[model samples]
Target: MTVSAPPAPPAAQRTPPAPAAPRRRRPIAPYLMVAPLVLVLAGVLLVPLVRLIVVSFQKYGLDQLVGGRPSEWVGLDNYGEVLAAEEFWSSLWHTVRFLVIAVGLTIGLGLLLAHLLAKVSRSVRVIMLLAMVMVWAMPPIIAMPMWRWLIDQRFGVLNYTLFHAGVLPTRSFNWFSSPVTGWTVICAIVVWGALPFVVISLHAALTAVPGELVEAARLDGAGAWRVFTAVTFPAIKPTVLIITVLSIIWDYRVFAQIWLLRDIGANKDTYYTIGIWSYVESFSNKNFGLGAAISLISVVLLGAFSIFAVRSVLRTAQAADAEADAR
Candidate 1:
């Protein structure tokens, strides 16, 4: 039996090892597809932004823009002039004041509207949503004139109504005579225009909140405000923070409303913000260099604010994630 075993096959006669499957090269199809969009953005946005930064340091004017002459390099002289001017400081202060008031009112009103919309019936909600969308869709140009007419000194319906209702001592109270009254009108207009978008965002965020959590809080004897603070606000805090930052940005750059309403009073210069100042410096005064410097300063300030807000939001998100994981 030991000698009966067949001799082993030779190595050369054995089956060849199976050839390795060909390795696939990494696919670059995605990059190839997105290349067109990247090119368009570089041409449209990046190029112009770089040119703007370059022009900010040069004494470029309508002549240079129209190819009449080469721009003179002024280095930081334009920035120095802008910083030295009292007008720049005044405009900056006005801008800051307007931003604080408008942003506060817009956010507070938007949150209230969102809460109301969330508690409404579907049909009512649809109607309110449509109204908000309509308001949001209106152009600033149209809104400015409409508001102006409504607050007009002689023919305004507001004065007439208030006088007839005995809320005013006179039928023709000059609303724009004082700086306080003028700014109040401007802030009101900005807040009104900005409300719809904020409301829509906040409503969507509120809808995403868990109903069961709210119900549990209520069952534990929590009131409406308490339930919102305890069970709902934590969920929507990130969204609120984002909307607030956006509102700040939008309100900070408000120009049309203030500009259009400027001619209503003799002391309208009191209402001038950075936007108006930039326009005046660039177009009216024809000091393009100083104007660009002012604009750059504004951009830098806004960028700083945005960076701070982003860091705060990231911290909040990380904290939320940690808390979630712990649970």
Candidate 2:
């Protein structure tokens, strides 16, 4: 006997899904959990920023510090003074130049090394990454002094080696003798320290890149440069922009490397960035108000320069992430 087959249900007669349960609202637990960190940041960052803004408007100095006198609000006089001073302008130009050279070299080298790291075997990559992390973990306070010793005029390894190798005519070469040579050394140190972080960041971005896209490019007869410019760069563009801005901010405010390398007796002015100059003015010259003003001015300048770029790149990075997740 043939069994009767059940007929399929009509399309319109089938029950629809239960409408996704209306996507329950995200829990507030995450925000609540982060409240402590927010409070800590406000205490750490906002408090000092508020104090700085207040001091920027006042004539606060050693006299006020010792005598307990109320700080007299000078109403932009400090700003005017800083704007009119040749020293501020000169120091500013020096800082700007340093920022350009240091950041450029750091990023360029970091990108090269990151690409090299990505191509290496996994074991080699892990070993090199650990070495880079060690360098990155070193504090500037310790590293700068070591670097200063390494480039010392009479006994520095650099000068000694160069002299022995006949790369130099003299047994000793003073790196701090001139601004050009001094800045070169400082930038070299800064770039060397910054390289690990930059390379790590770019390498992370490189690892996130899709292998299939790269393979497709290569299979289409695309050369290395063409593949990089077309496929590889788009994946890492956001990271590059973000790193560039951060490098600008970091290199602009470099203090230790410059301060340590400078000669205590002289040639200090020749290598002073705004940060070093600010410290000297604040403590040595005892011009607290002027130092605060200069510090504020530098912050404003850097903030203005990076604010727009930061917001734009963050959005681009987020979008890139979403696209990657979709893939």
Candidate 3:
């Protein structure tokens, strides 16, 4: 062009992202909003906890309670007795065993169901979700009774079906005759009740996994288990860990199922777990101090376990984060 094209004016200076709108100041409103809940928890949980520890050191039996006399401070006697008692140790053993079985089955079955849900069509998923929700919504109070009926010696559907199917030798099997069989049924119910929650939680976690990652793994010829362990599980590891911790805590404190079954004449002493032992000691045995001691011990043990669990969760999360950043 004859006259070198008029020089283009320099572009206007770009705004520097408005200084990133200044880092947001976290508002105090949220803290204030939760203050009421904190107070309520203090009143309900903290007050009872303090009372429990105080009573644990004293002989707080029904005699003292009814006689209007101050409790005798027994110091370490309750702890020594509890530690030496065979009943306490037996209860602990049963509790630990049941905890392992229930939590394991619940987590395993739940994980399987969650993956199945992911692969199912929308209608199938909806139906499965509705079924789980129904089961989950049923209170243990109601659910236990239903389960008891199913396993009842006389009119139990379980016995009828098993007898017909030749799975059981007799038409009426005494499920509660031995600790092993009784516990098997009890564990089944516990696992059943616990599965819905686990499945739902895991499904939610699974839903968050990136489709691209899954597809890439498949494209690279990873089989189902390989894909799960490599691409899918790593993504949901934090959720799984957290759920496992929760399952441990909840399963450790199981009481209602055993109590209801016992109340209906399931068995005596055979089915006693730690929670049942605590209740029996407190009310039935009228040894409140011992019960308090047991509860305090349980609280301490649980706290220790919770600490370990929290550490695991944190460690895993940190590891995952580092791996992600490395990528």
Candidate 4:
């Protein structure tokens, strides 16, 4: 054999990529499965959103809807009109006030309830929880009228009792007659409706607290108050934050109670929020543009709140997860 490299075997041909593992097609599978849901959401939500945006620029009225097309684009005129109006600003302030009072009271009451419920026997806890849930489960319409009846001038049990007990001069004091009083009643209704959920969430979170950690705190000469502040409180702080954010969002969108109160006698001009204002402008005044603009503004404010809440949640969750992983 010639010592010359026996005709060097051609470099073994690279086996072509092992056929790419049959291209396990999964990414597009998830998308295909979700396509129906995407279509449904687009039809229900996005379509209306697009129309609302368009109408926010166009002039549309009930009569126009009956006989014509949207004729003109007002550019920023609708927004300017809303911003320049005093009621718009007033309504926004009222909404913030309502949210602060309602959410504060709700959280406070909920925390107290959760704490109390945690110490009670199981039977008693269930009874109390069921009672609270009854209030929460009641529809706003039902609760609104019932609360109104309770505060009614002549027959309201509240005023009647106050008068009979000599706390009031007469039974003629109507809670919804004054804006401040009406607002307070509305806050109470909202708190009553919202507190149950917070209580339930917080109660669960509290129960999840490690018993050994609590025992250790107690053995360390920590008083009940100190143990709560240092251990139990910190553990439940995230739950409280979530509850507060939810309550704020709920109170901000409250319209049924406020609207019913307004219908009963509360001054629309005095007791208003972005929701009520948008409704009145859109339906009563036939100002779709103004209504949409007001709604968009409200959405912007809510979006900001949601962003803050989400960021807070992410931070807390990340911290908890890190702690868990470290353990």
Candidate 5:
């Protein structure tokens, strides 16, 4: 036991633990894959946005635009001018009116169509859905002109039918001569064009509703209206809200339809929505700076509305989740 302890296992033979291998870094393949998309989006969207903001602050004119030279910096002058103009307020009012009427009618009709599609036989539903898809696929530019032709003052199918049916006092009735009629036609066109997508989306949402829940409600002697209000609606409420917000945004910024049909009205000024006004200022009037300012204001207003809608929806959803958790 006292033997020299085998010389303490010779120091030279002792082995120390090796340092851990450096952690292999995560592969950057994912980031590399997305880099191109990020670059493209920045170029297309971010660049233009920055230019718009910059132009809005400057006194940009045709000379500056053509020469590619920086214009005089007019701090807030463009914004001030736009805000002080009566035309801006008038255009805003027109936009609001169009948004309200078009969105309301579009959503109402979409819900009706979605409900009908949900109830119908598979074949009929498929046929109706296909028809809707066709309409939705049609470009607005093409559809707008087609509508104009159909309602034209001369040789128009609508006027011909109405006159023959005794619904019109004259064989050639001018639909666009009066502001009331012009706006009505415009709203109708927007509603018709928007309906297909809304209906399809709502139909899809409706189809996701639990059949058991609906049947249970029915077995409990709940009427159709009661069953829909209590069971079906709650499930699709979020979808409806989202579609309504989207519709509002779409109708708020409607341009091609209004612009194409502006001259149809006796007073073209009557149809000057914010979109039309922006175009007129930028292109027609060659006041690019003022137009950009108008556009920025419109964007701010729409953005505010969108934020409110999103927040409301989120609150409702969170409250629902909380209630479920408590239950």
Candidate 6:
């Protein structure tokens, strides 16, 4: 009788869980919001880039394009022709030189300006920022002509003023006559044109530095210079690298300054960047294939730089994650 009672008590049933209501999918509202931007980018940027890449491999001449002969594929022959040409190599070297000088000048001056402006009062900082913006907003063409005029030999205001002040030996110092002098002047103009953007970007980055972090460094016995080198430098380094890379790219493709100077009777041979060489190949020599090849080489060089940039970003991200984990 006791065994039968225990067995009856052990037969209690377990309840099953209630089925979960099917999760309503999240509304696609955010993606829909970005659709306009996606469309704009595809239309304005991506389509053009794809077209350019396709046209680059084709043997299309100005005449062929106009007459509608239809461009035929030429494979790597165009690239071989570009590589075999002396002018292409020389132009590439010139571009490399310009990039080195321009990037150095831009980053060095920009960092100095950013550091100085970062320490200024709020109102003064705003004024400085506005001034930088004004320069940045001005077109390159505007500044190019002005620089050309200022450096002109005969009937130039800068030379006239210098001669009146007895600073220069003669009233007509040829600024763009000599190849060496012309290149120097062109590089100076390019650096000046690029400086404002560098200054503003780095200034913004510097201003974003955390005061608490800076104070902590000071508490740990770091001096102004030490704190800047150790803390501020590290914090703004990513922005600095980004700006430097952009400057490198811009400087590498500099054509207007060189062209303007050349038009002003300066030696076109003074500074022939890859851009100028490509232009000459296409329009001057009517060799579209060689021009396309030169452009592709330029693309490869820039691509290499981009690869380096990506690696740098990835390394920095990994280091940051490691540091966070350690903390």
List the lowest-lDDT window of 10 residues for candidate 1. Answer: 47-56
- Candidate 6 to truth, TM: 0.82
Question: What lDDT score is found at residue 58 in candidate 3?
Answer: 97
The deviation in Å at residue 275 for candidate 1 is 1.8
lDDT of 1 at 116: 97
The digit string of per-residue lDDT tens for model 2 on 206-325 reads 998889999999999999999999999989999899999888888887887777778622567877678887899889998788889988998888889888878888899999889889
lDDT of 5: 0.90
Candidate 3 lDDT over residue span 99-151, tens digit each? 89899999999999999999899999999999999988988888887888899
What TM-score does each of the candidates earn? 0.87, 0.85, 0.88, 0.90, 0.88, 0.82
- Top-lDDT candidate index: 5
lDDT of 5 by residue, 1-327 (tens): 575534566678889789999999999999999999999999999999889999999998888989877799998999999999999999999988888889999998999999999889999999998999999999889998799889989888999999999998997799889888899999999998899999999999999988999999999999999998999988888889989988998898788888898787589988899989999999998889999999999999999999999999888778767865885
Model 4 lDDT-worst window of ten: 13-22
Candidate 6 local lDDT, 1-327, one digit each (tens): 455434443335745679999999988999999999999999998887776667678787877767878788988778877888788778777878778877898899889988888778989989988887887888888887787678778878889998999997898898766766677778888887888889988888987888899999999999999999989888777788778778887887788878877766556765678889888888888777667777777888888988998788778757756765786
Tens digits of per-residue lDDT, candidate 1, 1-327, equal: 467778889999999999999999989999999999999999998897777678789998888878789999999988888889998899999999999899999989998999999889999999999999999999999998899888888898998999999987887777778899889989998988999999999999999987988998989999999988887889989888988899999988888998899888878779878889988888987878778888889889999999999999889888878877997
In candidate 4, stretches whose alpha carbon ends up further than 4 angstroms from where it belongs are 1-23, 27-30, 324-327
What residue pairs clash in candidate 3, if any at all? none
The order of the candidates by lDDT, greatest first, is 5, 3, 1, 2, 4, 6
Off by over 4 Å in 1: 1-26, 62-67
On TM-score, the candidate that comes out on top is 4
Residue 63 Cα positional deviation in candidate 4, in Å, after optimal superposition:
2.9
- List per-prediction Cα lDDT, in the order shown: 0.89, 0.87, 0.89, 0.85, 0.90, 0.81
Instruction: State each model's C-alpha RMSD to the native.
Output: 5.4, 7.9, 8.4, 4.2, 5.8, 4.2
